[model samples]
Target: MSTQPRTAVVIGGGITGLATAALLAREGLEVTVLEKQPETGGRAGSWETGGFRFDTGPSWYLMPEVFDHFFRLLGTSAAEQLQLVKLDPGYRVLFEGQTGPVDIAATREENIALFDSLEPGAGQRLEEYLESSEEVYAMAKKRFLYSTFASFLPLLRPDVLRRGPRLARLLLEPLSSFVAKRFTDPRIRQILGYPAVFLGSSPFTTPSMYHLMSRLDLADGVLYPMGGFHRIVSVIGDLAQAEGARVITGAEVTSIRTEVSGRKTRATGVQYRSPDGTLESLDADLVVSAADLHHTETELLPLELQTYPEKYWQRRVPGPGGLLLHLGVQGTLPQLQHHTLLFTEDWKANFEKIFGKDTSVPDPASLYVCRPSATDPDAAPEGHENLFVLVPVPSDPSLGAGGIDGAGDPRIEKMADAVIAQISSWAGIPDLAERIIIRRTVGPQDFVTDLNSWRGTLLGPAHILKQSAFFRGSNASRKVDGLLYAGGSTLPGIGLPMCLISAELILKRLRGDTGTEALPEPAPWSATADSRPESAGRAAGGDAKPLPAEPSSGDGA
Candidate 1:
């Protein structure tokens, strides 16, 4: 080992980036994080308005194990640093034209009992399905999630190959198909498939293996920090600082520096514009980019230094985007739950409009509304409520065509009115529009500007077979030797847990931990394979393929 310590410069201070920096610093490496935003958390950032605290992105905290493991790796637990409360009824769903809402409680028995009430025999089916899902989750944690796939041999292990048939079955069936097969009720299917929407894909196309989300949801339970998700970043930032990592926010990286040698074009550092608009250069031994894959690959690095061609992006399926609304109600909402999904009558047709035809809005729209104040009273002032509403919209190129202009867009106002009206009707809360004390809206255009997301996709790429695993943006960049990737867009796909796992996998790869315990290998499925040509450019325009019928969905509630 060299006498000098390893120095790493992390680009982006999002959850994955901060996790990576903190982990690296704990490993005895000198680390520095550069964040373009004024603060950390990236999409999971938080803000305060009129004394109400709201997590701007990622309201639900799922997969507490991921966070626990991360903190444990640094010789601590989140409980010691921050107060975490597990939600009882994880979330509630209000189906279109339904009289009562569906509550997803924390306890497995309660969840089963609730399901049993909806559909006779559903409780037993749910138990069986969860058991299977638990197995898959266990396998994923050991094999696919933790290991780096630089070589094929590790995945080809005997035990993993033995379970290839089961994995293959999961890859071939969609979450909808899987849930339908397991439970006879449409309501159960809807409940099981609800999480997929969070993944930026529909249950009709997402894989069945993603149903493991339900198992993870009930088994691990959903959690929230006292101050919201941003507290996660603050705690991690504190830990990083304690570990001697320098964090510099409001530093916009302009370009990456690399050596001339063709074989060893390692990242030297980055040239960035400071918060004051002054240009400065910082040097490092390695660079980790936690920004969106498109921005990091297409814009930040020099063209000649790029690894994959333009054709790669063309063949890959990018994730979806939407309009986000943060509202502060003047009075308390009696019936509102911590989390709620208001569905439209035509779910399939709505998806087709967004993903298939690339339309601007769904005819009958479905939305996710989160009111954290319901569970945590401190989230809002006494007798007041805080709400975060999200409507899935097409992340098409035309999102900025006069539909979103300085928060005064007529379309946005119309959509917000529609949402509030629907909520009022469902909960019997009269004059919801009149109860609004404060409001903030972020449309698809805002996602593009603030997060640098391609086509304003909230998540990175669609978790289709062709865009997952080894096929996704390589963890280690093809062009830059010392650069690696972690977060939603990279391997392991979208969501907080997956992104955290991505960070761990990339760090292990960077530290040359390739020979550690091998993970289980997924069975060969044509849909899961990477078929795009190397060096695919972003300029090539093509529609994404329909999502695969595999077993994967979005993150937890």
Candidate 2:
């Protein structure tokens, strides 16, 4: 055995890649991260023009504890890395036919009252609903979310065995049906069910297991980092470098180098296109691709060594791709909150258009609008407001990308025009379209071109019954011994917080930690660092203890 630190190569410099690099470096592994873009952040890309800054992806910060846990393992805290401001009215929602928009108040009591107002005697029902959601959230964090599901035998453990039937029921029920069971009001049902979209799923198809999402914003509160999600990228980048990880941007990983011995295959390293456009290969003890799982498994590795082949993806349903509109409005808008959701009257039809058999863009699009400038002045100029809008569309890449001003694919521009006018009439911002000074649009096609998203799905595989929790893709390669994966596409499912959990899972897999021991605290020493963040990132918290056997998934990976 050699005494040298093990070398690891991480592909993609997105949140997952940066986080995995930082943690692995702190664990004393010599890690190198490769990114194709000029900067990190992958799909959570950023843009700056005319003094306006926009986070091109992932606007909502729903799960605070996940952020807290991720940072704590790395010897920092979310409070210390980024200035977190809790939004008072977490968000405002405009229902098409309703006279007044409703705010998801900062406090649960207020939210309960708001729900009660919409539907008689619904306040107590909201309480019961959130309680159940919180319970499921707790169960998932402890068992499912952080698990690799390395084996299905864990399902036989006493605790899990007892909860198996409950868990199954939760997974089997659609989130929309689950919400409808508790709330009679359409507004209330929509409010509880919309979190499914954050997972790149429709409320109608996503499992009720995801209802925990409502607990985060409704009870725990929504948070915004001062500089948008880009700050998260910055924090991870700095930490990775600080912890001695070599991060290279403008380096596109083209293939995974593998070795076959007898019946086993193991990844040796990766070949990439460097900044100078030279083809280069780097050898390593192990490889982790934080890029899209489909692209990583199908395109990067040989057919024989693949954990997930292209044909395998044919059976999986994908989450919705989106038309992202980043607008720099010239004047302040008093009507909009820091976060707002404009839902069309025909809610079912709107979702049916996006996720139904037709798979078409909705005419009167139900969209999400984030005005970070309401909370952060620096997001816009003195009298201006910056808007980050998301319109769920089909995952087909042929819809095409968008350009500056009104210069975009005719179809995209047409939809953009319709949504802008829809918000004007619905949200009561009459001058909304005219006031735009700077504009950029990112479509499903952009997701493919920029992030290598498969089928142009923005959030990867949808969290439907057969595609969520342990049923999602595994984190390790089946055919390749030393290859691993980390990102929204893999198990535990989508969202920024899930990306952080995916990183921790990578560290756990590398350590061969099958037991449910929580990650250790910082050792208050300089042995493993040339800088700060001197702790091994691990499970959130709790004393070392044995966990139930875990359920496993197969994706080749």
Candidate 3:
């Protein structure tokens, strides 16, 4: 290796890719980020039409701590970077057969009361559940979420060893069964289990370990970064450039260039097609593929260079895809909150259909709806609403892609029409379809064509126990030197927070650091400045500002 200055090339400019570029640049490595889309953000991107701005990806802003940690690493904070609105009654739930929607208040008391109203004595059970959820979350945030898992010994520490039995039980029990054991009212059970969908699995399949997700919303409250998640993307993109990293959009990485020398194989750089229709190559000391993991392995590298080859993926289960709708409504929606979840009466059957051996879209689907205009006025024009809807379905690319107007694939448009009618009737908005002046549909095939998503899975691999935490795909390429991975497809599971942590994992792997804790707040970072992050550390005392604690918080869409 020629040593002048270390350089890194990051593939895909989605949230993880962008975050990786900024972190790598801050580490003093020259960095370049390539994004295939015209814009960055990947699944977290947004769309604008009819004077309305609809967030296309990741509508919820859960895990405030993760957001803060990522920004602090970049010498900033979420509060300093984005306009966040802490939603009151974090979100509302509309269970089938219910006369009206039940609000999930940020305060424990209100939430307890809401649970009690649904089923008597359920209030006390909720308190116990949240307390347990908090405990599990505290344990997970440290040992698992930030873990490199390079050593199983760190998890053998006394504190963790003591919880071994409990941890095993958590891993063994299904989240749906766990909730059902506590709350008899199906609505209460569904409320507790619904978070699994956001994690890209059905509750019945997801282990009880993920009950920690409930602590985010039912306890902490929900936040929406104004201007949508794309704003966060732009902020990270800007930070990368500010740190001297080059972010190139409309650049499609065709292949990761590699060479075999002596006995070892290593990634030297990548070849990509430029916007002007020319093939370009960039040489780097290291390369990080933050694109879809399966695509990177199966398509970007030769069979011999592939780490997780096609045969490896054949045994894996893909996450659920989405039937998404972005609609600009003509008038206000009184029945819906900023975040609304309409649960189907047959929650078990609904999930079965979505994640079954022969998967299909659920007819009486348990769907999520986001009306951003309720929180951010700028989301819509006057007297208008920007509604983002998601109904989980099979991750089969054959289901077909989405389109504008009523022009999507027949199967996709049919689902959209049915969902529109369902939501209109359930929410008591008879004219909902007619009031939709602008509509956009995104189906499973959209994920395939637009994102190179394996099996059109919207969130990568499902968070089943086997596919989670230590068992998840490794971030570093085992056979290729100077190659790494980040994003949902790798270790630590799904969602925006996990994506950010995946980037941190890349940083750790590069530094040969195996400690499983958030890196300390580095003293003012700069491009080409490779000073050790001031340690001893922010956990004890540092001049870094305190992380903001909001309405005790949460978002999933």
Best by lDDT: 3
Between which residue pairs do clashes occur in model 2? Answer: 154-549, 154-550, 307-556, 519-539
lDDT of 2 by residue, 253-348 (tens): 999998876776777899999889999999988788999999998899889777789888999988998898889998888798999998887988
The CA-based lDDT of model 2 is what? Answer: 0.82
True-vs-predicted CA distance for residue 32, candidate 1, Å? 1.6
TM-score (all chains, Cα) for each model: 0.89, 0.93, 0.93
Could you tell me how far off, in angstroms, the CA of residue 75 lies in candidate 3 after the best superposition? 1.3
- What's the count of clashing pairs in each model shown? 21, 4, 6
lDDT of each: 0.73, 0.82, 0.84
* Model 1 misplacement above 4 A: 1-5, 401-406, 515-557
Q: What is residue 262's positional error in candidate 2, in angstroms?
A: 4.2
Ranking by lDDT: 3, 2, 1
